[model samples]
Target: MSTPLAAALEKALQGRVRRSVPVTDLHDDIIPCPAADLFSNDYLSLCTDTRLRQAFIDNISKEPLVFGTGGSRLLNGNASAHLEFEDRMKTFFGAPAALLFNSGYDANVAFWHSIPQTGDAVILDELIHASTRDGLMASRARTALYPFSHNSAASLRDTILHVLRAHPAIAAGKATAFIALEGLYSMDGDFAPLPEVVRLVEELLPAGCGHIVVDEAHSTAIYGAQGRGLVAALGLEDRIDTVLHTFGKARALTGAVLLCSPTVRKYIINYGRPFIYSTSISHSMMCALSTSFDYIESSAGEELISSLHHISRTFESKLIAALQYTPSHLLALPARSTPADFPSNVVSPIFPILTSYPIPLARFLRNLGYRTRPLPYPVVPRGQERVRIVMHARNTEEELDELIAHLLAWSLELQEEEKKEKEKEVLLATEEVATSKSEPAKDKALFTISLPGTALRIAVSVRSFV
Candidate 1:
């Protein structure tokens, strides 16, 4: 009981908590079907694609399974499959070379720990993935988390200028600075204005002073040209220093790859602790990944990506129209402060709709048959709790309509709560007035009604959701 680890775990558990919800109460076979799925990351519907399943079976049937590589890639674990996967990724990403990692977390850890030299500095977005931040914390170099406002090029310039001012050694050519950012923010479903950031790096900072770094774990896999990602779409591969892409999202697979120069790859291969310590991916998984890439090149891949975007766009337009009705409290991003109108320029399939009572509302949706999850405190900041919805190619228009219907019902629920709360406040205020009326000896504490009681009934709405 007095163990240090136990004490730490106890401290960490002193709050509202979560538990794993099994698909079935007992086994995977007894899965319960939910109404609408809104939390999946399979943007392309590739996970259930018949072609991919066939490819997996074909590859596994033809090739002998290599079980698990018990050693790291730097050791005897290195295999032809591993090398081939890396090569294919490098070519696909248009990079000088590419390196593999067990997952995005490992890739980020290796990158942050090894790349920024001792004298170098790292300026990263405050909202960068926790994995990336963990890696930064493990690094030997100095690192600072800049504000999320750096998503704007102008703000990025200001933040860099401010950082360089404080750490003059970096600006004075004494130490190098690296700017780290996300290509497409996974949580907010927004972009980083990378072109502007890239321009700032190219013109404002010298080659030796700093370089642009991006984590494309969300965007590049299924968003842009031929599912290559934002970096490729913007032709930023030659400009940005290090870009991390993973198969977990759109590819519906495990593992990640880092696209950089062969020299940098060599450095990471030699010095990156995460890459050197962890066991390599399974041989069958590697073969499946290889086959998946092959599928990504086919006409089917192009159609799915296109279809996903179209469905997502259509869903967005419908949701916008629904949430904009009079007295609506549903909040969307880019208008965090309760905008007069929600933006219609949603380019991503992910959206975080704010809710004051997220868990109850989420549970209500779940019981009503939607697989919607509430993103609270640790997932997002407090008071910014949300119902996060992710669209996939397989999400039908009817399912989207049903989800929106539930959302509208929830919006009505919020309205009802607000109305009840308002009426209670009014009653309390009237009681206070009656108490003052009772207190008056003469005219000493005479209570006055500002307007007719009927007028008060028709009074203006109070500041609520805002």
Candidate 2:
């Protein structure tokens, strides 16, 4: 229910605007949802993998099954499974060390708060995930949100300069400046201008300035060699400082891993308040996460990745026909879309459908058994609200057909509705004009006017003329 404070908002809309906390509105239960699965993050459908299921059974049957972590890791929360998993990840990802966190949110929060000393500043893309901003807010470090580069190095440099100007300590080399970005941005489904930003940092930033941190959450388990993510795929392992890999997306798991230097790992273990204070992940969960990594290196995992990629490209190839739209708007784009996230570069299974009637389209699809994610105002900018459709490896061609057909129908209906709305406005304006035109001469004003070219003064009463 909406609170008394939400009265204006409640009255402003007539739809099912339930005042509630936010959820991605991705997909419903895996059991039975009477809708097309077009928005789930289970990209590779590994959640239902038989091997994973076997691992789950095998781990569950192990003697002395532990249900809890007992306490936080610093206390009695650490487990053998946790250590084993970390070691495997360290070796697997080729990082100096790997640290596990309860979840991506926890890892990011800890990193943002623990790093960046009071003198240091965090320079992030304006569209960086909210969790990062919240973490920075908790820190004593100076924070600056910069304009998105949209893949332009010059634009990124300008944004960094602006941040430096605002934080003189960073300019004077007294404080470190951390550049934050994502390997794959969730909303826009775009790749960050990482190389360019790193180049800028190398060329312009003062020595001992700071590090470039990245959230490879969405891209993990999808891109890169052995599914390390787009950063690894681009061979940018040396350029990035810290990388956050989430197991929630393509991996279909429930935790996160932070890849960084061993020194940084120790620092995080000690100073990362979130890790020290929160309950350590359970041994069972840790074991399950381990199995996931093992599966990623298997041939089945490789095949799944290939299939998912094929699905993404195939779906993208068909988006134009389904959207029935021009490639100029924020939502519409071509297959394998590269640069210009309005002037950022992006390529992913996510499709953002920008529309004037976003809520209606989402609702219509929902009624037709398609679960779509509608991004409304506040979630996105007012005019940039969109319907986000996530493509999955498990999704079939028939599902794509259904998605396209329904989307086309909705677009046509919206077009007609928009036309009618415009017609109504024009009619109202025409009526107002006609009323003024037919107002029978209230009073006539005679005026002496000189014609251009004739230069003759003429007295004329305009009221007498039609």
Candidate 3:
């Protein structure tokens, strides 16, 4: 069983084993058990929306459904359903043109791989999604990729300036400069300052040379008028060069669409390998996407968005209050200061409960019937490990209260444990001091009480006693 690949994989996965949790035994009726699903990306709870489900079924049943696309879009898979959906998306999202991809990951890969020709530069947020990085890595266009501080406008400006200085082509407007960003960061659960970022990009790069690309994977079906996304919400849709709206999250469907100009779409169609080679999505999937968008624009969808906002505000306020007295190093939220001029309507469902012991905290919550995922190093930066909690529109006040209570309980338990451990260390130090009292003067050594970094690594010196 130990082939060359197997051997290499075994060595590489020594300490980082990953496993999937099957959902066969974790359902409530036809949908996932909501009581424990705090990690799913279904922010709008559209997966369980009976109306959406029925609409999808009815739409697919309207005519003969194509279960699978025969070939790639460039081949026989270019069905009318795909074209109609793209047109609908362009109108709905207010984009000049729209192109569909299998998923957000696929769209990013295709776009990043095909766009940004030689001599161009792509400035990315340090914490941008891995798919973007993969696309850039696979890109044969010789485009230089630069990363700036996460969500920092100052850093972005600096990075763009540095790139311009380093590459005279970009400065002279002979090359394009693309800025990649996410509307909602999944790990830290923070919104990118889209307005500030767009403004900086326009000011730094040469006129008509700079392009802003935003991936609204975690923000779609949850923001703006009818969930048009942060770009549309901030009135910067005209300024942004390209936008990626994923259907997997709040829309509770599959696939993604890249909103760009007609020229860009045509270029991707010709050069994007993934789009040209991969089989297009089925007609049924297109029907489902159409249905989902229909529901999102409905009054019920508006009500859900309002409910989600209220829940987000309530949860954030309550959690902050609950953690007011807890030690920060043990468990706390990431210290993100909101700008005074930032929009108040930009709320996200993702919440990160920062902790040094993310796995233990996540396990504790899971044992209490709250399923949250722990993100460790590489997923998040070192020292930024956390348990990521995603809120849903279906989440009730009672469920939220119980979750908060359990979090508080965990925090209190940790505090009590640390207190007892400190006492034990003090007693042990005293015992060591007494024991050293019987030793000869020269033999008596300085005693130090050890503590973890969470306790500030207190160095209790018994030198005086000795």
Candidate with the greatest TM-score versus the true structure: 3
Consecutive 10-residue window with the lowest summed lDDT within model 3: 19-28
RMSD of 2: 9.4
**RMSD, every candidate, angstroms:** 6.9, 9.4, 4.1
lDDT of 1 by residue, 22-60 (tens): 122343222234555566777888877888899888888
lDDT of 2 by residue, 1-466 (tens): 8687698655545233542113444445234357656787888888768877897678667737557879998998888878888898888888888999999999988898887787776777777887788788888673454545555577778877876888898889898888888877778777776776777988888876868899988989888767888777777788788999998888887889999989889988999988899998876777677778878878878888887878887888788655556333323542334543221112488777776456666777777766565776657776676788888777888888878777777666655655675565556545544676756544454444443222235554444343
Span of 10 residues, lowest total lDDT, candidate 2: 338-347
Which pairs clash (backbone N, Cα, C closer than 3 Å) in model 2? 150-344, 151-344, 190-346, 341-344
Local distance difference test, per candidate?
0.73, 0.74, 0.83
- Order the candidates by lDDT, highest first: 3, 2, 1
Of 1 and 3, which scores higher on lDDT? Answer: 3
Tens-digit per-residue lDDT, 1-466, candidate 3: 6799998877656535442111223352333553556678999989888988888888888858648879999999899989998999999888899999999999999999989888888999999999999999987644588899998988988999999998899899898989999988988888788889878888888899998999999988888998887788888889999999999999998999999999999999999988898999988888889889999999989989988888888888888888888888767887875544556877777788888767667768867666566776556677887888788887887878888888888878877877987787768767877776876545343444434323234445565344
lDDT score, residue 220, model 1? 59
Residue 388, candidate 2: C-alpha displacement in angstroms: 0.6
TM-score of each: 0.84, 0.83, 0.90
Of the two candidates 2 and 3, the one with more favorable lDDT, higher being better, is 3
